[model samples]
Target: MLKSLLSDKPGARPLVEAIRACRWHLLAAAGFSALVNILYLAPTLYMMQVYDRVVPTGGIITLVLVTIVVFLALGTLAGLDVIRTRLLVRAGLRLDQQLAGRTLGRAMGSHETSARAGQVMREFDQVRSAIGGQGALAILDAPWTPIYLLFCFLLHPLLGLLTLVGALMLFGLAVLNERSTKSRLLKAHEASARAYAAQEQVSTRSEVVRALGMRRGLVARQLTARAEATGAQSEAQFTGGRYSGAIKFLRLMLQSLALGLGAYLAVQQQISAGAIIAASVLLSRAVQPIEQLVGAWPGLVQARAAWKSLTDLYEATGDQDEAHTLLPAPAGRLDLQEVSVRMSDGDTPQLKQVSFSLEPGQMLGVIGPSGSGKTTLARVVAGAYRPQLGAVRLDGSEYGQWDPERLARHIGYLPQDSVLFAGTVKDNISRFEGAADPAADQGAIDLRAVTAAKAAEVHDLIQSLPQGYDTPIGPGGRGLSAGQMQRVALARALYGSPRLLVLDEPNSHLDQDGETALMRALKRAAEAGAAIVIVAHRAGVLASADLLLVMNKGAVSRFGPRDQVLQALQGRGGPRIASVS
Candidate 1:
């Protein structure tokens, strides 16, 4: 255990590293607690002196002097306890600072449908709460158990023996508590994860669920999941509480039993009246830490489980954000050499051995039937989905070799289904630039956002809103039409005038005028020396393309200049003619 705690192996868990780094804090807190416990003996010794020395000698002056000095010692002890608690809180905050951002970043870069991606944050919260609070205090005080027992031994051998036996019994109960609740907590965690996942799915597809009258069924399913989780959690907590209650009972009874035993010893002239009370006091102090440990057991288990879960997730995802030397920003050159992507759920391959290349100022139109790998190709181009086989490169450097955030600045992507965050039109367009920074120059940010909106042809519609670019959108905010959402997403993709633009059916919800605006946007983007890839089934959307690619399943059926592919397809004019232009 000591080796594991001290070792900083290559793949050591982050939580372990946190504990290791806070070792000094833990030691300092324990040192202060030792002093407090020693001072705790002051009260017991004072009682011994009062009954055995003060009452017998009629020594009022001695009693007052002892009282004064013991109170001062206890006051210092309380102050030390306060400092110990503060140190633990600081350690917890430092641990949070170390892991929170990394966990959030990994979650953000992870797949949108990832179940564990969201769980890491909650797990970290559990760890932080457990570390800085009562659980840690109990652990810090636990080591003094043996020292308290030794004090009882000095008072009388029989009292010390009783304390040792009582401590063993209470420790046994604590072990049993762990044994009873460990599996239940694990089950509860799994059930809660399922419940959360079900609720997230229901929320994301709320429209369809409500429209189809499936809301009742979805809600019922979520409730059932939540019930199972809550039931398991309640059962485990009940078991832990039962054990803690038993430990408390044992601690109280042991002290009373010690007093009784010490009285018998006094009657036999083995000890004095002072020793009787001192024996009980010493036994209580010995049992105090064990009782506190029992109370803290459940929280400790939860933190341990959370640490294990986070470590497992980090290992499974392998999302090591390497900060290698920055390659120069990509120059709009993209190459795909026999790329293929396998579905995570063991579905059929989405794209198979599809290869293509694009240069600066080139615009490629991908026309295919539904599920013919068009959207997959667009995602690959935008670096949204890394292919399982082959490679994607920009400017002769592998995509993984570039810093993702920097690479993202040079890439623009509009998914098949448009998405809008809970923010203003300008915030969505500017990707929350000035909004995230309260001190940013808002006027300059608004001007830049408006320019992008005009480029996507959503500026006039936005200006018509109650607050123009600052108009709120999302749940409880101003609701935009489906076409408006698509246009705003388009404006977002075009915001930075990115060197590489991937639009997966950007005009899916657009009207005739919207389509015209989209054509102009594409033309302007291409003329500005940006490489654009569009996945569209609409023949009219293809008229502005400089190159054409057709997909008959997952394989490319045809690839050539726009006029050649269109002319050959026109000569044939088969079933695909309407979709491919």
Candidate 2:
């Protein structure tokens, strides 16, 4: 199962590639570490000579010189060790930045279904932690271990053979552990994803939960998800730990055997005492790096899993075609012909052969009962989704042919939930990326845009705040009420001065007075020659529209001038239409 999860994600290559691209720096650090190990190994040989040869010769001066040389060698190795550490740390930081950039870039285009933004963020953090922690050491140690083993073999081939066998056995055990715990690791990943999703949802809808008196229910659900995740993690750790313990035991036995054999050979005079001592020292040095690699196995697995997850997300979202050449702004003429949208299940269609058109500067209000596909139709018109069987044309040009950014410049879309970022009201209004217009500039405030805000009736509310337009709204504008948020959204839409505006349930949460203000804003926007299309439920809002479109079962059941549609609806005993001011 872990293998399946890893294989399922093709997007992981970029992350892996990013790491591999920094191999030169890693190799340089590994070289320095290897040099330090060699210097440190010299002391053991010199000490053995002092005991076995120098004392027999009674060479007191030679002993003093050898001791000083060993200390110098030790100091040199210590300096090199510091250099290697610094280099690896620097390289790891670079990798972190690269990973963060790649992850965030992928998040920008990732599919909504995959919940990619959060996933990418988590993966990027994991990759960073892995590199900064044991990951760099593992890279250095894995390759350096063989070099040390070769040095041991040069000291004495027999002891080298024994050490090689032990290392091989330890490696085999680690591989077995990895394979056995693979499924557990995958389960843990899935559990973590579910837990994160549940937590995020609970956080986002905390207010709703409290209002509906479902706080206990939400808390219970969150706890269940967290528990499941914790359990899965525990199981994975237990399984991995069992195999790790066994491997460590086997390694310890092998090291002991190598030490015993070396000492025996030295006593028999088959190998020089200095050679035996060097072998023993090299063997000891090998143990820590070997153990480190073994210990790093779990992190490697997790990094792989994270890599795969990121890859899957990127693949799913990155396959979109490049945006075409930018097209000129449309005349606000839109037409949808034989449009149909089928859900992924391919059984129930959300929209079926729906068609409509609006003349330039016209105000069209779409009314429908719940589940009548009103929002779906608006999304199709706004170019959020492509229809399965038809086309959406704006000013005689197909939406797909126009550059997405350019199309956005012409069409303003406000979804049911107006997402606000962590910024002041003015920042949200001027989301456009460019130099400030000199004519609109007023210190930190854009006076021209602020005038639009006043027209939208949100200007007074903003000024009432402690910082006025500069007040830092927390994430998602949590500081603002729903009505205030709606007006802010409207002001943002108007700030773009878009040729066409598509709003879905713009005033759903507004009070009567706020709704009146919204109507006035819409009338002003229409008078400015901006084509406005709104999905509305209230008769008061619908009555003010120049045209009314009533949708039923994914198709337009009635559409005409407001008065005609209202008269027909009243005659049919449908909802009464209110007067338009």
> Evaluated with lDDT, which candidate comes out highest?
1
lDDT of 1: 0.82
- TM-scores of all predicted structures: 0.90, 0.86
Clashing pairs in 2: 11-311, 12-311
Candidate 1 has which clashing residue pairs, if any? none
Candidate 1 worst ten-residue window by lDDT:
1-10
Assess candidate 2 and give its TM-score to the true structure: 0.86
Candidate 1 residues lying further than 4 Å off, grouped into runs, are: 1-24, 111-113, 204-208, 313-320, 435-447, 475-478, 548-581
Candidate lDDT values, in order: 0.82, 0.75
RMSD of every candidate to native, in Å, equals 3.2, 4.0
Off by over 4 Å in 2: 1-24, 58-60, 99-102, 319-324, 337-347, 383-391, 396-406, 432-445, 553-581
Q: For candidate 2, give the lDDT of residue 560.
A: 89
TM-score of 1: 0.90
Per-residue lDDT of model 2, residues 1-581, tens digit only: 22453333354655556666667767788799778767867777786778677877999888988888988998898899888887777777777766676667557644244533455677656656666567567666666677778877877788878778777777787778778878787777777877887788678777888999999988898889888878887887888788778877877776677668878998888777666656766776666566776677667667777767776666664434354766766778888888998765447787888888887778999987777789989888877776778988988888778866578777777778877777777887765332324565454347646876887888888899889988878767789887788888777777657778899998887899888888898888778787889998876776568888888877788888988887888889764446554
